[model samples]
Target: MVDNSQGHSAYSEDALLVSRMNVKPGGKQAHMRDGWFMRDGVKVIQQMVYPPDHPEFPNEPKGMKAVLAECGLSQQRLRGKCKKCESDSLACCYKRILELQADFQEQKSLMQEVIESMGHLSIFLLKFTAS
Candidate 1:
């Protein structure tokens, strides 16, 4: 006979089992707050919490250097140029190169198709002339 008047069963063991079932198998859960993770004894930031101009992360040359590195451009070759100018020039040049490559591939495919058609036509003509 269990007491049902208090909404909870008379067996406290059932409540404990239910609570434990909700918990993950990990040793401890990491709590996230404001883009930070508290794991074990360490407090870690999930992202760049500081602004670019912050002393820990300088804004000027580092950004340009990162951009140049990503674009595979040499900083020494573009020493005097502004970041925007260099980036724009690189973007335009890359776009032109990509367009040229696409055009070359299309022309190559078209040439292959033409060559195959010519071979078929020549074979047909040779057979017709022999007969």
Candidate 2:
């Protein structure tokens, strides 16, 4: 049996009486009862969010199994999830900081090289002028 637990308003009789002229044509606006359209004993309820076990869900946490079993609904354990997220964010931030530090070191070295070359040019100009 199709799960109408989400409160779809589809009727069974319309599907069986397909040839009857009075039967509403099947569509979103067709056999609508209780805010849902009927199509072969199935209600046209939106099914965007699949269960956690579904492959489309992606990286379903082990903690989610407990939530589904206990509450019959999917819920995140924010305490643990948030902690892990914060740790990952911190790691990313540290990695970026190290990269920036390396870039800054390279720029500083280039600046030092330019300053030394300018000093040598000044010394050469002074010696030639003195002669």
Name the regions of candidate 2 deviating beyond 4 angstroms. 1-95, 98-101, 109-113, 119-131
Residue 53 C-alpha lDDT in model 2: 67
In order of appearance, the predictions have TM-scores of 0.17, 0.14
| Clashes by residue pair, model 2 | none
Highest TM-score scorer: 1
Model 1 worst lDDT run, 10 consecutive residues = 14-23
What C-alpha lDDT values do all the predictions have?
Answer: 0.29, 0.27
Candidate 2 lDDT over 1-131, as tens digits, reads 22222223233332211111111122222121111223466654322123556654332222222322232332233222221233335223222222222222232222234545677421212122344
Q: Tens-digit lDDT track for model 1 on 1-131?
A: 22223232232221111112212222222221122333466654432122465675432222222322333442343332233343345333322222222222232222234445677421212112344
**lDDT score for candidate 2 against the true structure:** 0.27
What stretches of model 1 exceed 4 Å from their correct place? 1-62, 82-131
